[model samples]
Target: MTEKKLKVDLSVPFPTEREAQIACGTLSVDSEPKRGGVKKELVVKGNVLNIHFEALEARMMRVGMNSFFDHLNLVIETMEKFGPPEK
Candidate 1:
């Protein structure tokens, strides 16, 4: 029998391309290699950040997504607080 897998795709937009790149690079650095069933990808395209996630089980996928969003919120907050003055 074959195992089932799941994926989640997300895109986040920032006010500037530099901000998007910063977030992409920072988050990418924080990511750890998976030894089991989860994978993540992040890319920056102009002022947008694209995220992809893959997991082996529904529960794992859900947990991964939730954790990602939580970390994302922190990243956004940090950018807002420490990023260059917004225009």
Candidate 2:
């Protein structure tokens, strides 16, 4: 039997395009691990960062999303603490 594909979409808005770009760059560096059965994609448009996730199972999707949120929180915190990088 063919496995079903589950998906999730997330959008995060930053204060500026630069900040959004920075977050996308930082977060995109770590692709989802192969064993997790999840795939992730990141993109930045204007001041918004978009994330797309696909997984074979709901559990896998939940785990992947939790991990992503952890990293995203760090990125936002870092931006809030230190601001965006220099142009």
Candidate 3:
């Protein structure tokens, strides 16, 4: 028999499984739900909280900053789109 595996697009990852205990959490990420993913233990170099949404972060960083206000606004927008700061 063959074991089917899931393709985990870590593009969006919850802080912990506890955060996924409800629908408003990571559960709402995708309706189909990502199942059968092989759990891999990782030794993070630094505090790796929500490292999956990197492309989104890069997109935010690409915005042109004409002044301090523009940069602040962009940062605020990014925080709103992404979650809170990692510990």
Candidate 4:
């Protein structure tokens, strides 16, 4: 029997489109591991960062989300400390 997938959608709003794009680009660089059984997609829509996650099991989903959030928190903190990058 085929296993059902668990999915999650997350939307994070930034002060500017530039910041959203930066976060998307930065986070997208680290793709999910092949054996992790998790898939992640990141996109920027205006000032919002959209994240979609899918996993074969709840444990996989939770672990993937926790790792992503840790990276996300660091990204937000860095943006807050250094401000936007120069064009």
Candidate 5:
């Protein structure tokens, strides 16, 4: 079997840097402007094309693994409420 990478495209309608930042609450960490998909790997400035990688194991957390899962669920819930803002 091979490793497959999944890409998610966000359909936000913001066309300006300030609009993007205010709408999503993420500051631009880049010096130059950009548009479109980011690299497959993680980028310092998580944006429109950010990819989140999940590890199979949870080894470094103050709480137990179950607590981590619950925390993740809360994150998802927040995302759902925010409708996946570019960050």
Candidate 6:
């Protein structure tokens, strides 16, 4: 049996490039658990954060996306609570 391949791409924009970069850095720190045919990538472009995910199956893709969103939410909250000092 052949596994179905899935791909997901998401982009999130922040008020400032600094915040976007911070979120990207935090999200990139840990990689997905060793799961075959699962891949994730995070990047920052100006004030936008980009995420790409690939999985061998729909279930795996959903789990991976959920995990990413959970962490991404934390990153956003952290930036909101303790962002750079107002200049």
lDDT of 3 by residue, 1-87 (tens): 854433222222334433223212322233221342223222222223222111122223222112222533454466557775554
Model 3 alpha-carbon miss at residue 28, Å: 35
Write the residue-wise lDDT of candidate 5 on 1-87 in tens digits: 854444332233333443334433332222111232222122223223232323222332212323433543554466567664563
Which pairs of residues collide in model 4? none
lDDT of 1 by residue, 32-67 (tens): 447546788998989999999999888777777787
Residues 1-87 of candidate 6 have per-residue lDDT tens digits of 976678888999999888888888888998888854579988889999999998988888888888889998998887778866353
- CA-RMSD of model 3: 13.1
lDDT of 2 by residue, 1-87 (tens): 998899899899988999999999999998888999999999898999999999999999999999999999999998889966788
- Candidate 6, 58: how far from true, in Å? 0.6
Between candidates 4 and 5, the one scoring higher on TM-score is 4
- lDDT (C-alpha, whole model) for all candidates: 0.82, 0.92, 0.31, 0.95, 0.35, 0.85
Any residue pairs clashing in model 3, and if so which?
Answer: none
Instruction: Flag clash pairs in model 2.
Output: none
What is the total number of backbone clashes in candidate 2? Answer: 0
Model 6 stretches astray by more than 4 angstroms = 1-4, 85-87
Provide the global lDDT of candidate 2 against the true structure: 0.92
Q: Which stretches of candidate 2 lie over 4 Å from their true place?
A: none
- Per-residue error for 71 in candidate 6, Å, reads 0.5
Lowest lDDT sum, 10 consecutive residues, model 4, at 78-87
Best by TM-score: 4
Query: Could you tell me the lDDT of residue 38 within candidate 2?
Result: 96
Flag the better candidate by lDDT, 1 or 3. 1
The TM-scores, one per candidate, come to: 0.84, 0.93, 0.25, 0.95, 0.28, 0.86
RMSD of each: 2.4, 1.0, 13.1, 0.9, 11.7, 2.2
